[model samples]
Target: MKFSIERGALLRAVARAQSVVERRNTIPILANVLIEAEGDEVHFRATDLDIEVVDKAPAKVERAGATTVNAVTFHEIVRKLPDGALVNLTDDGASGRLSVEAGRSHFALATLPRQDFPVMANAEYSANFAAPAPVLRRLFDKSKFAISTEETRYYLNGVYMHVAEANSGRVLRCVATDGHRLARIDAGLPDGAETMPGVIVPRKAVNELRKLLEDDDMEIAVSVSETKIRFATPEITLTSKVIDGTFPDYTRVIPTNNQKRLEVDASDFAKAVDRVATVSSERSRAVKLQLDEDRLILSVNAPDAGNAEEELVVAYSDEKLEIGFNAKYLLEIASQVDRENAVFLFNSSGDPTLMREGSDDSAVYVVMPMRV
Candidate 1:
């Protein structure tokens, strides 16, 4: 393929495609993005068999053809090209190498047959819907921190996205839990989305989709089937195979009748959790929360190291309660509440506790407590 594309445009397109390509690959073609030029546009497609991303940009096409080159080498060459220069990509169809020329920089990279690229077969999506970028972004951002990394429980490694009944009628939801804690979020349901199938999107796909939902007002077109799901913006389309297993019954883990309430500033709680956890052992970061009347003292004690304590004034009228929870877990969940206060609902020192943003029910969370 022969095409003359601007340096900036080429860099942006290649960078996006290459970021999806891992550093190491068993298959040679999997490490390269197929570059095709026709008419006035250049298309770049990259895939790892399970996940495929295609990006397109405007280019000056001299010859409508296609070729493949190492994604990393092509990206590095384009990145080093002088600013504002024009880049020309040419393949003679016989040399088996693609030549990249831009100003004083030039590269000749080995090419692979475009036919070797594995593209996902088109599917008849059972459901197709659109959501505002901000809405989709909120669903992932608030829950991603809690995604499980346990490979055995593959279903817990991704956010569970589906339709649910909320106080305000039906709403779209995203829930993720590692059994220790869970993050459940809800947003207004979009049109034509009530019948959408519940999909346990793999962790990697959620991260890739985040990059496309940065613009708050941009609308994303989402297509779903039993085994694969697709999320697309105006310029890019990302397709991936969904996890085949069923997610655990996460609702049973979220507490419902916790009565002891503690309300404290979210930032203050997070800072205290961070400081106290530093003194505890890495394997057992149990921070003891000593609450009495309106005074709350958070402390962590490790035999080998030292102890740390931070006191904060809260709005708790309950009797004295001492509870221990994983410091890392507390810190992570506390950071998610983007408000002045975080309300904790506790049953006892050992029972699972619930947390929320002040009195808001839009987004709720549950954290299992640890024994001191």
Candidate 2:
């Protein structure tokens, strides 16, 4: 295969594909990216058995052929090349090496037969829909932080994406939880997505997919089946197997009766939590929140380390309430509230607390309290 592509275009395409290739692979071919040159474009494909990503870039093709080469090595070489230099990739099919040439730099990388690369079979999608990039970005970005890392409860290791009824109407939702905290975000459902099957998008896939949603105006075509899901842009496509498990019904965990409301500046609250948490022991970084008519005091006490206390004026009118929570959880949830004020509803010190941005119910968070 032989082709010439601009360095910027080559690097971007290869970087996207190579991220799916793990550093260590049991199968040699799995560690390489399949490079195919044809017509006026070149395709870079990489997979790690469970997930696959393919990216295409415009190129001047000299020969129509395909080969596989170490994804990491090729990416590094292209990354170091001069910004506007044109890159030439050539493989003779018998030399067992791929030649990369750019300006004054040249290198030969060992190649594997393209026929050995495993490509996932095409799936029959039950639902296909188009969503604005910003909408999809908000859904995943807000909830992914709570995705579980525990492997035993595999179902909890990803964001649960599905269609559900919200107060306004039917909405697309993404929910993630790690037992201690949960994030629930909703967006208006797109047309033709009413029958979309709920899928647990694995954590790795969720992170990689975020990279494609940076362009707010871009439209993403999403396809989903019972066992697999695919997200496609104009030049890239990502496919992955859905987690084989059922997500727990999270409605019961979200408090609907809590009436104690405390509104505070989200940024200030997060910074206060961070300062107080500095004196907390690693094992139990708990912060106690004391609320009065319109005052809130955050305090942390660690026998071995020290004690910290900070007071902030807030909007609270209910009966005085004192609650304890994991400082880290509070900080994370607070940061998600991009708006100026974060509204918190509390039932008691022992029950889970609910938080939202100002008056927005579309994006809500639930955090379990810890005994201080």
Candidate 3:
């Protein structure tokens, strides 16, 4: 294989692919980036078995062929090369070594057989739909905070995507929960998505998908099957197996009858939660909320560390009430409220509380209370 690619173009493609390659691997080929050159394009493929990323870029191909090289060493060498240098890569197919040349610099990397790379089998997707990048961004951005990292409940470690009924009619919904808190978001359903199966996209897949959705208006094609899911754009396609487990019934955890309502500036509330939580113990991050008439005070008391309290003028007319919740959970949920006011609806001190964007029912959240 022999090809010459522009420095900028090569960097962009290799950087994306190499990130999927882990630093250490028991299997030698897993640490290499598979480079295939044909026509005027070169494709770079890297995988860690579970995830694979392939990126293509325009290159001047002298001879069309394929080879694999250490991903980290190649990336580091190319990164240190002088800017605007044309990079030439050549491999004789028998030597099992790839030579990289740029200006007066040259380095040889051991090659691995391309036949050893593992590829995920294709699946018959039952549903295929398209969504604008911004819509998908909001869905993941708002809900990712609630994704659970607890390994035992692997189903909760990703955002659940499916169809559900909303106020008007059918809507696409994404929900995530970490047991203590839950985030539920709804977007207008795309055409032909009514039969979409509920899929728990693993956490890693969600992060990789976010990178592809950076273009605000780019339309992404989504395909889902029983065991695997694929998301594709004009330049790239990503496929992964879905978590083979049932997500707990998140709807039951959502509170519907919390009567006491308190509305406060979201930014101020988040800042107050941030400041007060600093004094709380790490294990039990409990913060007490004291409310009366039109005032709300947030306080945290840690046995080891000093206590902290913050007062803010709020829009509350309910009788006096006190409730406790994890300071970290409160801060995270409050930060999600984009606008000025975050409305909190509380029941008794021990039950789960509800929160939403002021009076907007489009987005709803629930947080289980903690004992201070």
Candidate 4:
């Protein structure tokens, strides 16, 4: 197989492919990317058994054939090549090596038979829809931070994407929780997505998908089935198996009756929590929030490390309440608020507290309280 592609285009495609390739591989072919040259475009495909990524770049295909080479090595070589230089890749079926040439640099990488590459089986999607890149980015970025890393409860290790009934009617919702905190974000439902089945997108897949959402004007085509989910664009395609377990019933944990409302500037609140928590023990980086009338005081106490406190004025009219929460969780949750003010609703020190943008119910967060 032989192809000539621009250095920039080749590097971008190979970089994405290499990321999908596992560094430690039990199978030889799985560690390599399948490079196929044909029909004026070259395709680079890589997989780690569970997730597969295919990147296409325009190229001059002089020979129509396919081969596999170490994804990381190919990416490194292309990345170091001079920018704007044309890269040529050639493989003669019997040489057992793929030749990479660019300007004054040349290298030959060991090759694997493309026939051994495992392509994920295609699924009959139950729902297919198109969503703007920005919309999809917000849904995943906001909720992904809360995805649980615990392996035993495998279902909680991904963001749950499904259709839900919001106050304004049907909307697309993404929810993620690790028991300590939860993020739930909603976007307007796209056409033809009404019958979409809820799917738990794995953490790795969520991160890989982020690379595709950088273009604000791009529209992503999403396909979902019972077992697989696929996101595709004009030049790249990402597919992964959905988690096999059912996510916990999260609605039960979102506080509905929390009456105490405290509206505070999110940036200031996050910075205050960060500063005071510096004195807390590493094991328990907890910050206590004291609320009364229009005043809120954040303090952290650690017997061995000393203590720190910060006070801020907020809009609070309900009865006084004191609650403790992990400083990291508070910082992450607070940063998600794009608006100036973040509203916190509290029921008691023992119950989970709820937070959201000033008056926007579209994106909400629930954080469990800890003992001070």
Candidate 5:
């Protein structure tokens, strides 16, 4: 395989594909990025059994052929090359090596046979739809923070994406939880997505998809099946196996009749939580929030370390309330509130609390309280 591609274009494509390649791979070919050059384009494909990402870049093809090379090494070489220098990649098949040449630097990397790369079989999608990049980004970005990292409960290790009924109408939703906190975000359902089956998009795929949705105005084509999901842009396609498990019915976990209300500046609240958390013990970073009328005081007390306290004037009218929560969880949920005020609803110090950005119900967060 031989092709010449601009440094910027080649780097971008290889970077995207390489990110999906795991650093430690039991399979030799799994560590390689498959490079296929044909016509006027070159394809960089990488996979780790469960997930596959293919990136296409325009290139001047000297000979149409395909080969595989270590993704990490190829990416590092291209990243260090002089900016704007044309990169030439060539493989003669017999040498079992791939040659990378730039203006004044050249390196040859061992090549793996392209035939050994495992490609996921094509899936018949039950639902296919298009959504604005911003819409998809918001859905995943708001909820991904709550995705569980526990491998035992694999179902909870990803964002649960599905169609559901909202107050306004049917909407596309993404919900994630790690038992202590939960995030549910809703977006207007796009056409042809009404019958979409709910799927748990693994945390890795959610993260990879975020990179593709960075362009706010770009439209993304999404395809969903029972076992696989695909998000495609004009230049890249990301495919992953859906977590084959059922997500818990999260509705019961969301507080419904929490009456005590408190509204505070989201940024200020997050900062206070972060500051107080510094003095907390590493094992349990607990922060106590004491609310009375329109005043809110945040304090952290760790016997081993020192203590911290901060007070901020907030909007609260209900009876006085005192609650304790994990400092990390508070900071994460508070950061999701982009608006000036974060509206929090509380039932009691023992029950789950709900929070949202101003009066927006489209994105709601539930955080379970902790004992200080």
Candidate 6:
């Protein structure tokens, strides 16, 4: 196999594919990327058993063929090469090695047989739809922060994407929770997505899909089946197996009739929480919010450390209420509010609190309270 590609283009393609390759692999071929050179493009395919990514880049083909090489080594070599330099790759197929050559640098990396690379099988999708990059980006970006890192509850370790009935009509939604906090975001459903089945997109796949959504003008083609989910563009495709377990019904946790209301500047609130949290106990990092009339005071008290407090003039007309929450959770929830004001609804100090951006119901967040 032989092909010549520009350094910048080659690096971009290889970087995308290699990110899917696991650093530690029991199977030798699973650590390598399969490179296939065709008429005018070269394809780089890499997988870590659960997720697969294929990136295509335009290249000048000297001979159309395929080979496999260590993904990390190839990516490192390409990244260190001089920008704009022409990179040539070649493999005789029998030597069990792939040659990478740039200006004056030459390296031969041990190769695995291309046939040994495990390519994910093609899935029969139950729903296929196209969504603008920005729309999909908002859905995932807003909710991914709440994805559970706990491995035992595998179902909670990803963002749940599905179609649901909304006040305006049917909408596409993404929900993620780690028990302590939850994020739910909704977007207008795309045509032909009505039949889409809800799928829990694993955290790793959600991260890989972020690269494809960077281009605001790109339209992402999404395909979903019972067991797998795929996202594709003109030059790249990402596929992953959906989590086997069912996600908890997040709706039951979202507060419904919280009467007390408090509206505060999102930036100011986050800064206050962060500052007070510095003096909080490292183990708990609890911050308390004391609210009455139109005043909100945030305080953190740690016997081992010192205590700190900050007051913010907010818009709260309800009766007095004091609630304690994890400082880290409050910061995360506040950051998701794009608008100037973050509205917080509270039923009591013991119940979960709901927050939203200004008056927008499209994106809502729920945080479980903690004892100070």
For candidate 1, give the lDDT of residue 299.
90
TM-score (all chains, Cα) for each model: 0.97, 0.99, 0.96, 0.99, 0.98, 0.99
Clashes of each: 0, 0, 0, 0, 0, 0
**Candidate 1 segments exceeding 4 Å error:** 281-283
Residue 97 lDDT in candidate 1: 91
The ten-residue window of minimal lDDT in model 4 covers: 277-286
Q: After superposition, how far is residue 346 of candidate 2 from its true place, in Å?
A: 0.3
lDDT of each: 0.88, 0.95, 0.87, 0.94, 0.95, 0.94
The runs of at least 3 residues in candidate 2 whose Cα sits more than 4 Å from the true structure, single-residue gaps closed, are: 281-284
RMSD of each: 1.2, 0.9, 1.6, 0.8, 0.9, 0.8
Q: For candidate 1, lDDT tens digit of each residue in 1-372?
A: 788999898888888787778788788989999998999999899888778888889999989999888998889888888899998889999999999888777788899999888778998788899989999998999998889999988889899888888889999999999988899999999988888889898888899888898888799999888888999887888998888888777778888888889999999889978888887668557999999899899998887898899999998998789999988889889998987899999989988999999988878899888888
- Residue lDDT tens for model 5, 1-372: 789999999999999999999999789999999999999999999999999999999999999999999999999999999999999999999999899999879899999899998989999999999999999999999999999999899999999999999999999999999999999999999998998999999999999999999998899999999999999999999999999999999999998999999999999999989998998658457899999989999999988889999999999998889999988899999999889999999999999999999999999999999986
What tens-digit string does per-residue lDDT give for candidate 2 at 1-372? 889999999999999999999898789999999998999999999999889999999999999999999999999999889999999999999999999999889899999999999999999999999999999999999999999989999999999999999999999999999999999999999998999999999999998999899998899999999999999999999999999999999999999999999999999999999999998668458899999999999999998889999999999999988899988889889989979999999999999999999999999999999997
Better of 1 and 4 by TM-score: 4
lDDT of 6 by residue, 266-363 (tens): 99999999899998658457899999889999999988889999999999999999999988899999998889999999999999999999999999
